[model samples]
Target: MNVGFRVHQDVLRPDRALLEGFAGAAVGNLSDAMHGLYTMDSGIRPVVTPAARVTGPAVTVAVSPGDGLMLREAIGLARPGDVLVVNAFGATDRAVLGGTVLLAARDRGVAGLVVDGAVRDLDEIASLSLPVAARAVTPRSGTSTAGWGEVNVPVACGGVVVQPGDVVAADGDGIVVVPADQAAAVLAAHREVEAAKGRPSDLASGGEARRSRADVVFHRTRAAMAERGATVVPAAYHRWPVPPGPTAASRPDRA
Candidate 1:
């Protein structure tokens, strides 16, 4: 019997300038602008203090639900601006990564780590000043079962299928995976969305006004699509309905 272990050494990435464009942009904006084409699920979040954003080409690893072997290998394989994306089946009881691994990744110039499972040593990891996004934290550590996983493979992280070289842009809003081939096109669309709406004065702002605005944007987009015979389903982001009286035609000014 033989185990199938593979690693893709060469993966094409988007231009540096394109990735840099996503530096401070909100992950939600990118997902909304792309019409949720590559949005990751919402459970995963940052554990580090003073949460930082990350944008880089992906170096994907597919491992067992509670294994860290492949992730450790991925750190070595990752490039300076690569985000190590691990598909760990969202297991939370056992931590697949910890402070030591994060420290090594930092030394290797890895941009960030996104784990669908759990991670340990949050305090130490925060001290390293590395951008890390994951589901949970625990004291139980995973076994180093090497030779059982694959690298640079298409892996599902936070419910999104991430392929090697796909651009990953993540922040407190969560992670967004953009196909490597669609990086430029998606970046352009993201720019358009930002330009049309401008950056929110404060992402932390909360009120009925914000909710109403979101609903207005959703309905406006839906109405525009309805005119073209395309029906658009409302996304999860819209927590409220459009206010009375303003239809798509009437809300063209709001976006």
Candidate 2:
């Protein structure tokens, strides 16, 4: 079996409706629904416009630091509305993606691109208007040699394990991974969160109901923290007195 150089053709994607539910969802709220986990590190941020919000199944790619052969193959294998998630071992010295290949991916109907490595051609990429999140950017391009890498396999990107076909919801906040099998449950939980924050319609209508709900939640949380042994000081930490120390006048002068 070609371990590192193989591609798994079959991937289990979640239902289209389930994925669609996350289209305009905030990554932060989704992360909270998952117990504040499954979020990519802050370093992996939107290199493109922050207004871009995308949700789709992930096509996982594991590429060597300075090579992008497997990534190119993954793009061809990706279906429309699939996010190409590339793991390049967080290498920043060389870029594994650039404008030229990004154009091809865009034309192929790829939803977005998230890389745990560098990428170049920001101007062209912005012009394309495809959502792109990466760890860094560099002008040095990767080699196209058929090297060791894997596609549609579990990979670590930005300190989170991403599985093939997992729902990837990315926005200005960051990227959040929802396991394919648990997508339904996560969506339900996310809806509950939104409800607790007050319906979007209420907030949009400039009603006080949303603010009231927020206040309730904030006070409840504060009380819970106190009950759990969180001490509340009457004054700020900076206003507290410092330990006694010898004053400059009390110290002996040096010759």
Candidate 3:
């Protein structure tokens, strides 16, 4: 199998600070900030829970599924703070990245990794503290012998077309790609949107509005029973005496 390996040496990169700003930016807001332009699929999820957010300029790789040679090479070629965005043909049956590859990226100061394929060695990767987002996880390891791959080229990952130097921003919500040239503009737009939305209300302040599952069910059941001609006494009013044969203004609390 003559797997042709292609490397584009003159790949363009965005400014480091721009990438950092996107990294620190909200992933949800970034997706909105893109205006439906280039959001990755939601299928790609963090392998480990409580995953850290990753943001950096993309070093795109187009590779055959179940192969890791190109990925390993990409890691070495990627500069510090670069995120390797890999198109693995959406093959999740075999692992494309694992402990060794992750450690290599971490040691090189690579920002993170996003793969449209499966990965393994979760325990090792979890301990390494490197941010990773992928389609799935499998125990099967991939072969590095596959020689066909292209580095620093436009590729598709998680159903999104990614070009070299595109900003890859990922967090709990998933991944969003911002074109290299549009990074600054998108960042600015996201900040504007955030400001316009205003600060979210604190959960503590809304505790009175929160209802448990059982409470909700009970209220719904009471309504249904009332429709059946059954007299319904709401829990709150049950403890008190009927006041003046229930004035029209004294309706029971429905919530």
Task: Identify the leading candidate in terms of lDDT.
Answer: 2
Which whole-number lDDT from 0 to 100 does residue 238 have in model 2? 82
Give the clash total for candidate 3: 2
lDDT of 2 at 171: 90
Which stretch of 10 consecutive residues in model 1 shows the poorest summed lDDT? 1-10
Error of 3 at 81 (Å): 1.0
Best by TM-score: 2
lDDT of 1 by residue, 68-158 (tens): 7777888888889899998888889898888888999999999999998999998899788899988999999886665377888788888
TM-score of 1: 0.76
Ranking by TM-score: 2, 1, 3
> What TM-score does structure 2 among the candidates reach?
0.85
Per-residue lDDT of model 3, residues 35-148, tens digit only: 866888889998887978888888988777888888888888888888889888889888888998899989998988898988899998889988888899999988664658
In model 2, the clashing pairs are: none
Compute the lDDT for candidate 1.
0.84
After superposition, candidate 2 runs with Cα above 4 Å error: 199-205, 225-255
Candidate 2 has an lDDT of: 0.89
Computed on alpha carbons, the lDDT of every model, listed in order, comes to 0.84, 0.89, 0.81
